[model samples]
Target chain A: MLPGFPHAEPLAGLAGGILIGLAAAVMLLGSGRIAGVSGIFARATGVASSSMPRLAAWAFVLGLPLGALLVMALNGPLEPRFLSLPWIAVAGLVVGVGTRLGSGCTSGHGVCGVSRLSPRSLVATLTFMATGIATVAAINALT
Target chain B: MRQRLTSEALVALVAGVLFGAGLALGGMTDPARVRGFLDLFGNWDPTLAFVMGGAVLVMAMAWLIQPRMIRPLFTDVFNLPKARDITPRLVIGAGLFGVGWGLAGLCPGPGIAALVIEPLSAAVFVATMLVGMVLVRLFEKDA
Candidate 1:
């Protein structure tokens, strides 16, 4: 039998989901911006603009690590088996290229785009997801 | 004049929480699990597909409610995009994103959410993502 209540981790995931929804909604209402990660990250890089949106984006980005710090303080540090820096760098470069080509990242298109029901977003999302599924398959085969 | 917080921000916050909770609960925050799923050719973990299915179901519900709701919490009118045709940009972007996700096993939301469990990788991913966004803004002015 599964342990009682399925495990606290799952509950934590539920809470995290609620937080994401709330953050997106709040950012839209308060700042008149979609909490799209690509847009925010774009602005933070000074490529978009240096307005309040950019400032807010910076805050949100910075807050991510801060939040993690808080969590670590409360729950103890995570023991990560760090992947090689070279692999991580390559991954980052690819993601950068993809986001630019896609017009948005998963957060922008996957979460917000799907919520808005844009056919383009839907199609784009499907493509990425299928790719992701395939890539996983391929990687496993190689390794 | 006091600047009232917009409903959008509130929405984003809630959504973010939900997203984070989902990551924590769904075991997506665990890099090892994510890597395992990406190891499709090897271990071929298929759990992520179920998670995506759950998200899609929620999205379907949102679609049903969106039209009837009429007014958005902040805007007088709900803003839907006018374009539906897929462009070259969309296809290329999706492809790139797939490559990155396949290699890294990280997407924006889950990536940011993963900070709670894996700070270093999350930080690097977010930072590099921001840089990519900036570059797009700088070079894609005509776009």
Candidate 2:
């Protein structure tokens, strides 16, 4: 679909996204929880509290990387890079703080909440998308 | 209770693994791919939009099923977010998250999923992100 970006895999993206949605659906139906990564991480780390059991939270967190490793073992290695060290650290810190304070991330707000037409999530998604676009624009201009 | 807890945790593991696989397959695990999507003004990659659209479409269906069911399959009650107010804190936090996402092209989910894909980089980001979470708890007693 993207002519400008030849490497842009639309089909893969769509399929993958569907799988993600299914994952969230499973979490909602089976455990009655939003698959908000930040929240799960927080609960596992004891930074947050909820009806979720700690063991469940830990299981989910551990499962994340194991799944990735599974993918690599099957499809070969993936080459994913970071923004060097300094910038990545800064980005990580800001994202962590922002997600906790805002009470959701891409999964919680962008996928689950937005689909349900929640007003707060709608606003949050719009705000983050706009800011994310603007920030990328600014970075491109500066660099 | 122990048996129930085990079931809950196993369900969570399945969801988490599916989520991680989806992220990697959809190309969200790649910072470059995510940045390309964010780089709207530059070589814009529309793959992320397709991913978002597909996920949202599926999630909307899941939401339709949510209200009819009193409780989830394994859990007694649903534990979704309830607050709906559009607050300054939410906007600010989301905006900051956008900045971080644009800068590193790594949000909470992708950041964690990339642990096995890009070990060193993902670890740094996750560690700093954890510290950021801790800082929030330390500074904001209300949080």
Best candidate according to lDDT: 2
Residues A49-81, model 2: lDDT tens digits = 888999999888877887787778877888886
> Clashing pairs in model 2?
none
TM-score, candidate 2, is 0.97
For each candidate, the alpha-carbon lDDT, in order, equals 0.60, 0.89
Error of 2 at B90 (Å): 0.6
Docking class of 1: acceptable
**Tens digit of per-residue lDDT, candidate 2, span B1-143:** 99889999999999899888888888899998899999888888888998888889888898999888989999888998889799999999888888899989999988888888888999999999899888888889875
Evaluated at residue A42, the lDDT of candidate 2 is: 92
Docking verdict class for candidate 2:
high
Q: Tens digit of lDDT per residue, candidate 1, span A1-143? A: 12442322434443444444455555444344555666565656665553334444556655444545445565665544435555655667677767866877666677667776778888888888778768767765676
Best by DockQ: 2
Cα lDDT tens digits, model 1, B61-118, are 5556565665656545554445678998898788778777777777666567666576
